[model samples]
Target: MKRVLFSAPSVRRLLLAALACLSSPAPASDRIQIVTEELPPYNMTEDGRLTGMSTEVVQAVLEEVGVQANIQSMPWARAYDIALNSENVLIYSIARTRQREQLFKWVGIVAPMRWHLYSLPQRNIQLRRLDDARRYQIATVKQDAGEQHLLARGFAIGKNLQSSNKYAHNYEKLTLGRVDLWIANELNARYLARRAGAEVPVPVLSLPDLADDDGLSMAFSLQTSDALVERFRQGLKTVRDNGTYATIAKRWL
Candidate 1:
């Protein structure tokens, strides 16, 4: 039957405490969500563990920054969509293109990439220029750098471009005659071919216009804090400077 009311000063102090708690930032570990796809020699699941050149480099960066986060492997389209829309999500082994410059806060280049249009050796597909290949059906991973690059150059899906969820699936389409050509980076094309116990797809055309010197990079979603992005950028630099990057590259590349 008794009620106690807080004094004005006490109530003010309690309100200020609540405001501070509400405004405080979330912990780094709580905000970061690392995602990547099955891109061989860079990011892939091998022997039931996530291990690759870029994955190792990213792990080193996380250690350097003292952040513990688990990397999840998913379909490239799904991972790309999550990174594009989610807050504090990190995606790796992603090519840095002019089209993607403003989309995310880039950490740094983790590995090299060279785009190419590949086909079966027997097909003898030859192209003197980029547009020459438009006559054939080209397989591309959905939302992948190669696909985006071609799409920017006016390649359309369904008509000429066949979009798939995985790079390996594109390669399969090329080999099975379902698609006349597959656009992929040099390392991924060769790695997937070897894994499939098949001959390396012949590179019929090189896409230098689509390739960037910055290579594939680790990047945080645009919603990520600038401070966190810079922390990762510096962490990546440390690994590159201390010879860790070279060692990892030698193992995979």
Candidate 2:
């Protein structure tokens, strides 16, 4: 069984921090700037713009609560760097890890990301235990939680393949005898697989569910005002209650 490091206690701490931010004063009313990568089933680009479940949920909630929002897309690593250095900035659907737990003010962890791995079924590759993955050349996106997990466990990964949306090319690499394993979110990997017609059945290894605690969060800067973050949080709640989140997720997933 894969043990998820972030459980109830750490999640409660993050929530408490969010609550504290919610009760404080906001700095300015300019616009909340959010940055995300162009990844599918979470954040994807259409017509050269970012639109997906996480994006739609956040945008709808902020609009509903009367707060202005500006969203942009960049590479995942670059987006994270921008969010860290820039003010009035946030990132979405970010996994909670030891490195990121205390980095920023947080809000609206909509749901836990169900993560897994895929390998050719005929190869009989299985990862019932994380230790079983050490021998294979695991491939994942740069700066993703899946990579982080494997690295922490001392798994030596393969070469840097190309960067494509949703690890689609990685799946192709595996199919064409280029890689041993592909690590990504369950829903996201499946979506990408169908998009590429890589219908070769692959084994998926399930990880722990973190819905009650380690779901997606909008991580804000320390300098951002509390009131504005509170507004977005409340707006996210309104969107969820009003079924905007569910609707968008249904349409996409």
Measured by lDDT, the strongest candidate is 1
| TM-score leader | 1
How well does candidate 1 match the true structure in TM-score terms?
0.87
Against the true structure, candidate 2 reaches a TM-score of 0.78
Least well predicted 10-residue stretch by lDDT in candidate 2: 157-166
Q: 81-142 in candidate 2: lDDT tens per residue?
A: 77778888878767766667676777767544676667787778867876676666766776
Q: Tell me the TM-score of each prediction against the true structure.
A: 0.87, 0.78
Q: Which residue pairs clash within candidate 2?
A: none
Candidate 2 ranges with C-alpha deviation above 4 Å: 1-29, 156-166, 209-214
Estimate every model's Cα lDDT from 0 to 1: 0.90, 0.70
